[model samples]
Target: MMSSSPESRIASLGLTLPSGATPLANYVPYRKSGHLVFVSGQLPKEVKEDGSAFFHQGKLGESCTVEEGQAAAKACGLNMIAQVDKLKRPAEVISRR
Candidate 1:
């Protein structure tokens, strides 16, 4: 039977889960188990035309508004998608697993 969870589907596709980006201080980035993925504690990432994600740290509710904070989160998501799209090919990574 197929898994009802999207994470299972991602794993079925042969993509290894990415471990959470743990911070040296008290911050965290993401987490994973088997084929599941989780992301948290991310600032807005500035992506240049060349597809580079830069962390732009600005305090929300102080330096920016709630809307701005949401935009930053969306930007971070876009950056990750861009990074994934840059992979050579599914056959390359998937086959290796």
Candidate 2:
């Protein structure tokens, strides 16, 4: 069978890509040089269904459990993906799970 596309997989997992985050400082979200696209570091920020922003806070080892930290990392990754989507390049950007 043919594998599903990334967007299909993400939707099947009930994951909605949040809007691209605004830079807190003087920096762009990503930069593309030739075939290589360099994405900046993303925070664990997300937009809730009610259009409110959410992010994980506190020190990981001191105030949060390992599992919580992992969740936060996943949020960060999602934010990064959202930024990449903003590039508007109609190509396969995600290569792995």
Candidate 3:
């Protein structure tokens, strides 16, 4: 049996992985040491087909509701996965810390 690739899985879900965001500062997004990779915190930003971005940009418990915060977290997860998919061995990812 042939398992679907990560990009295929994402496409099957009717989703597209947006381009990774540029670093806000001088730090790189991820660092790999041996088999372990540490991905930095990512924000909730989705790029549209026209290249505009849709993002939740407010502090939780302040201007954002619980549901909105949850959505933001999900977006962050997607972004992290997108970053991980670029790895040399994406299928080898064991667990996300």
Which has the greatest TM-score? 2
RMSD of 2: 3.5
Per-model lDDT: 0.50, 0.80, 0.81
TM-score: model 2 vs. ground truth: 0.78
lDDT of 3 at 74: 76
Clashes of 2: 0
| Per-residue alpha-carbon lDDT of candidate 2 for residues 8-80, written as tens digits (9 for 90 to 100) | 8888999888778888888989888777677775888767779888888889899988988988988987888
RMSD to the hidden true structure, all candidates: 11.3, 3.5, 2.8
The lDDT-based order of candidates, best leading, equals: 3, 2, 1
At residue 61, what lDDT does model 1 achieve? 84
Candidate 1 lDDT tens digits, 1-97: 6546545655576643333333557643544445544444433556555856566567998988888888676665544443343333322212111
lDDT of 3: 0.81
Using all chains and alpha carbons, the TM-scores for the candidates as numbered come to: 0.36, 0.78, 0.74
In candidate 3, stretches whose alpha carbon ends up further than 4 angstroms from where it belongs are 48-50, 57-63, 91-97
Per-candidate clashes come to: 1, 0, 0
Off by over 4 Å in 1: 1-32, 38-43, 50-54, 83-97
